[model samples]
Target: MFISETQIEVRYAETDAMQVVYHGQYVVWFEIGRTRLIKDLGFHYADMEKAGFVSPVTDIQLSYKRPFRYGEMATIRTWIQSHSGIRTTYAYEIVNETGDVCVIGSSVHTVVNKETFRPVKFKKEFPEWHAVYEKEKQGQ
Candidate 1:
């Protein structure tokens, strides 16, 4: 699998009263990782939006294994878990500087017309993007 890794410095704003990174922050990190993966694959999400299509999250799952503190460095690893004509699933793994896995997750998304909000087949609307996703998907 072609996994893209993005490093993030835990900020105080991302922490909670418990002094650990806020759980909700991981969701933002997931978006960062996914965006990096798409850039690494030579695609710009803005281009997709400019083309009048938007990929919206349809499902999401996350498992938190450990807590990280502010000022710590974390790496978010992301890859295409699966892809179909209509939907794509992206998997993620987050680890601390010491290389301990802190979180694992997946997000599913489907392309839709920006104005109509109607579902669109990725293979038909963005064949090049769909082809790269199919080629890099982790499993059948």
Candidate 2:
């Protein structure tokens, strides 16, 4: 399994009135982690878009273990949990500087034709990309 790590600094705007990071910000962080993971695997999501395909999240699960405060640096760790022919599941872990896991989540996504919005099998549409995912996926 290949895990990608991205460091994000909690900003004041991302915090709630209590000065703790807002819950919704973690969803955005998941995207950041996912994008970084793809790039680290030598793939560009832009290329997928240019190919007239888009991967959209169909399911998402998140669990919050701790709260992050503004000015703290958090690490977002991402990896491919599993990948079917048409759907891919990505796992994420957000941790504080001390290595305490603050959040854990996963998102399921499927590729769809941009124009028709019909689901497409990743193996058929992007064989190379699919192959890499298959090889790198965790918990086989």
TM-score per prediction, in order, is 0.97, 0.97
Writing each residue's lDDT as its tens digit, candidate 1 over 1-140 gives 78899999999999999999999999999999999999999999999999999999999999999999999999999999889889899999999999999999999999999999999989988889888898897443
- Cα lDDT of candidate 2 equals 0.95
Candidate 1 TM-score versus the reference: 0.97
lDDT for model 1 comes to 0.94
The residue pairs found clashing in candidate 2 are none
> Candidates' lDDT values, in order?
0.94, 0.95
* Candidate 1 C-alpha RMSD relative to the actual structure: 1.3
Displacement of the residue 80 alpha carbon in candidate 1, Å: 0.4
Q: Model 1 off-target regions past 4 Å?
A: 138-140
